[model samples]
Target: MFNRFWSRFFSSESSDESTTSTKNSKPDDKNSGSETEMTETSNEIDFQLMPTGLKKLLNKVDLSHPPGLAGDICEDLATLEYRALPNLRPAAAMMILSSVARQIENPPYKLNLYVISTALTASGKEAHQNYLKQALMDLGLDSKLHDTPRSDKTIMFDLLYSEGCSIYVLDEGHVLFRTALSSRASTFEKNMADLLLQLKTAKQYRLSGNLKREVQEQLIARLEKADKKKSNTAFQPEDKEKLKNLLELTNECIYDPFVNLISYSVPQNVAFLFSKKEIETGLLGRIIFVRGPSKRAPLRGHDKVVRPSKDISERLKAISTENLPTESLAARTTLHTIKEYLECDENRNHGMYGAIFARGYEQIRVVATLLALESKEIDQSMVIYAFKQFLNSLHECETHLSTQSKTSIEESQKLVELKVREYSERHGSGSFGVIRNNIFKCSAPIRKLENNQKDFLSNTLQKFADLGVLIKVGNNQYLHKSCISAKKLNTAKKQST
Candidate 1:
């Protein structure tokens, strides 16, 4: 029903805008249709002609009687024209909503989203991040907020500290992930990406550090100390038993870790972040991309953000990890259907469309849960609004990637050959003891990296070994032709002399 209403609303709105020229002329009674016919014509709405995206949806919403703080906060940002794009404000708001609301217990899956927003530099990404930070601080939920990552372990520590959920809203966060795309990408970057993926779907991820062993050791020391001081009131018989039991359970790590990362970056930088491998691994599909305009957006003269409604503030304040609303069966079914439909597109067709749709149904439900607030059941209106955000996000991501050229990607692929040549030069033997840092030891420039070189920096070397230009010396290393027979090399030099 909401879909029909949306379709008709857009159709009627378009007609009104297009028919403005007819208003000045006299009405033609003969052409004017009956009221029933007019209603039928409006009902026969062409969905293809309907204008979509969050801005159009924002314009139609009335936030007085708020569904939840998510939509209301978006409306507030939109009203102030918060110097962010039409979609980014809500993306931030949803991040806040999901982060704060994650404390809500018993959802179909975790309520948090892996969302990324991008725009041109000086396009207010930083300013918007500050605004979001201030908003979170205003609600007294500052602990959940984190800055850019200093190390790979920083996120794990953040999740450990913030009750298993941390929100990092970094302005140029893509730079960290971009390193993982390079051939020289460190284990740390790859591990970071892997850790994020684990945090996304799996509940109760265990920390492998000495946290458990250290706690157990401490517990044992306390027990032995209590035994040494039999009279000490600190360790009674019952307390000893409790301490022993606690020692048994100290092997625990993060249980139900809710980690949320919302990054804002430009399109070019983001292009280097994900490749086809990342897509197949489900990382690309899991991420929600909200792309802003190619240029900065103009401010609406208001220097400050309009404060959100009292209910929104109060509602946000009242949200706790243990007090979130539970999802209804109707909500679950709709979300499941959405997931299947998106997965179908992914299986049948191709591209990053499935990537956005990968989280589509789940994200929509998360938004709906925000809009529904205390009303746990999913409704048609809430689904429509939530779907609007999803479609806008999809459109933004698709449009953003569309701007990335195939020529540039072809160029990135050329790095493989460069890396291979680089490997041969750095490890191969040369006549002089000096290292020719910029020299290519290989006579021919290959178009791709070999398997050994790609992983262990030895890519395929058997062909060179077969040609006698190089010899396989085990451990994925190659003995240079000069190294194979220094006597022959010296004799050749002697002949030249």
Candidate 2:
């Protein structure tokens, strides 16, 4: 019955958009007797003028009431905007919604989304991050927030080892992931990407580190302590149990990690770096990209400083700790909605599109759950609003990428190669160490780095070789042809003098 209602409603909406196309194309009244025959012929030969199913579905949505949590976050962002901060109101709000969804237990689908928000530099990415940090702090979730994107090792060792879930708010994560997938991406970046994929899809991920040495050391220390205690008292069963549990920590090999990654970056630098293959990986599809509204100039003044109110802070604190509805009505609604989304997009026919539809279905359900709040059932209106928001995100990402040209990318690469070659000629010899130092000194020319500069330089130089900027002469040794040209020019000038 629900499907029937939506189908009828959408059909009517599509009909409305398709109205004049058919009427305007119809033949004149003089041929009225043969109108039926002409119409049939046109129907057979003419293209269908109906609005796309997805567009009509999105158009029917009422976005007035976003999920309570998301709405409140947006309001907080507005407060920041009033204070003259670079405002990413929409992006901040969606990220908060994604964070809330991460904490949900036994969700019908994975509620965690790899969210990215893109804005131009000085457009408030930093200020927006600060606002989000303050909001999370108000909710007593400040401990869960991380400034940098963690490697798979750190993620496992720090949060997942003890806590089941964590929310990492990383700045420039678009750079991290994009660089990781680029031609010169480092192993650490690749590992981080791989680990994220594993956690997203699998219920449990295998640990890669060795535990045997640590376990042996712990056992030895415990035995020595027990022997020392032997002189004072008898060995207790509890002591044996304590040792057993300690041993178990090393023996434990699998972990269930629920991590929500909210990343902020510049659109041009990050989003454009993604290739078709990356999108096909299903990882890119999992991301909902929110492009901030552009501001021609930065806002300034003491009058613009709007602090978060006590009421907003208290509300956020209350919601973070409140018990959500136990009923599965919202989850069921989400499942049904996902089914409809997939079915409706059947004619779209592309792997990336299908992946996106699946990911959006999950994201919408997450947003719906955040909106559900204390309500036992998810509202149909809220789910539709969330779905519409996802569509908007998809549109933004597609439009941004579509606007970029291959020539521009090639030109950018050429600039990077020239800068690298120039740096090598000025300061580096053929040795890796000297070349690496040169790369660091001129690192300002590099767009992105993972964790630190050293690894980035190494990976970048390797990429330069791959791009034919340098030829590898020996292990960890590279020679740039430009360096030779510079040397010859210097010798010629000396001879002329």
Candidate 3:
């Protein structure tokens, strides 16, 4: 039966079969040329490995198992490690399930794989249904299939608890799973919020078996620690204001599911459209935000022209599966590290990660996760370069990067002037205010101030006072030249004598 399924699958060839065959036949003719081309291409493709230092740091983590049932569970868990493979979704799923099943002690628990499709089909006549059936059979789990559709919750739960079923697979499941889980008569916004929340929670908690419960407990503990840290700090008024704004932005992104807002919109508009209350609550912080190319954007030359390349796709599939466990652990570690980093006021001033989060939250997270995974396996410089490239890609989609650069330059200049004036006033013999005003005349560039006359005047006056040329004796009243250098006074006295 397996042989029949495999042969049927491979025999049904697409139009590219002839091209593939021709390429295989001519392999020797261009072997040397292609090999050189491939080497250059391989060098060009960016593949950052983990740093040795990071690897040594990670090695300190104790991955060893404990005794008894705990040990047994850990041992069982080890067999279920299936990394995601490229361009081989069905095969990857099959491998993951098979590994999971092998770890179990009792064979009585049935595993049913439920594959969901986004397309609507009225009957079994749909080609997709046949395709799914074939895929299941190819995986050698055709007998485990439940004939009933998953749209019905009662049927789903029953199948889940049923003694005959063990593993369930859902293919192309976004719409179907979302619709089934949604509350009847709920607003689309509410449904989306519910869906995202459920997915996040499930991703954190759900596993092949009892491990789900253990993972949930660990998550709860982590949350508790985070909550305690938040409670310990008292925010200043400015900090409080910023936090309030950030929270409101987060809420809008997370809860508001208006199709127009969620599907395709500018980040600023998306942030502004959210309800003010939602932003204050910080619900958006929970989301894995992503900023990718818009569907409407024109394809680049590289993307627009594509030739059949099975070898490329196959190689990607193989590469994708190489570091699954490492990637997963790295993702968790990176998230926690980022959270800590963002919480610090000093680190916030650094602004690289913050800028990425503001523009491309999801992409930054993915890049950070990948970097964490590779931190141990690659050179430090290579890892840093890869991270910079990831950040650059995110920055390219948004205008924030240019703005940040300008702001940094302006702030640095202001700091330099302020520091020089402060030092001169403290020790120099000249009138501090006069020196400050002269310095301002020499160095202070004109600013295009709008609706801030009072602030502008205040800053100007402060600069003079810092230089010791002027002193404010009363409200809005200034005393100039309170004291002059002793050299000038001595010369006047000597001339009079």
Best by lDDT: 1
Residues 173-252 of candidate 3: C-alpha lDDT, one tens digit per residue: 23333343345633432333433333322212122233234333544554455555665566345444443443333223
lDDT of 1 by residue, 332-398 (tens): 5545555555556432244434454556666676678766554555565566557655654544443
- The parts of candidate 1 lying over 4 Å away from their true place are 1-68, 79-84, 209-250, 305-311, 318-340, 343-359, 391-405, 408-446, 449-497
Tens digits of per-residue lDDT for model 2 on 1-497? Answer: 22233334322332433332221121110101110011121112111222355445456553322545555555555445522222245456655555655555555666666777766677546667777677666666666765565454455544432355667788877666765565676665566677777777566654545424533465668767776786555667676566656455555554446777788877676755444456667776677665553432335333544445677666554554244444356546545744564546441334335556556666776666666653445666566667766755655444444444334445655655676677666655466667666555665655443232346556656777665567654465666756657665455335434
Error of 2 at 305 (Å): 6.8
* Residue 161 accuracy (lDDT) in model 3: 31
lDDT of 2 at 367: 67
Q: Candidates' lDDT values, in order?
A: 0.56, 0.54, 0.30
Task: Report lDDT (Cα) of residue 468, candidate 1.
Answer: 52
What's the alpha carbon RMSD for model 3? Answer: 22.6
- TM-score result, candidate 3: 0.25
User: Ranking by TM-score, best first?
Assistant: 1, 2, 3
- TM-score pick, better of 1 and 3: 1
Tell me how far the alpha carbon of residue 348 in candidate 3 is from the true structure, in angstroms, after superposition: 7.4
**How high a TM-score does candidate 1 get?**
0.59
All-Cα superposition RMSD per candidate: 14.9, 16.1, 22.6
Instruction: Pull out the clashing pairs in model 1.
Output: 103-321, 104-324, 285-355, 450-459, 452-458, 452-459, 453-458, 453-459
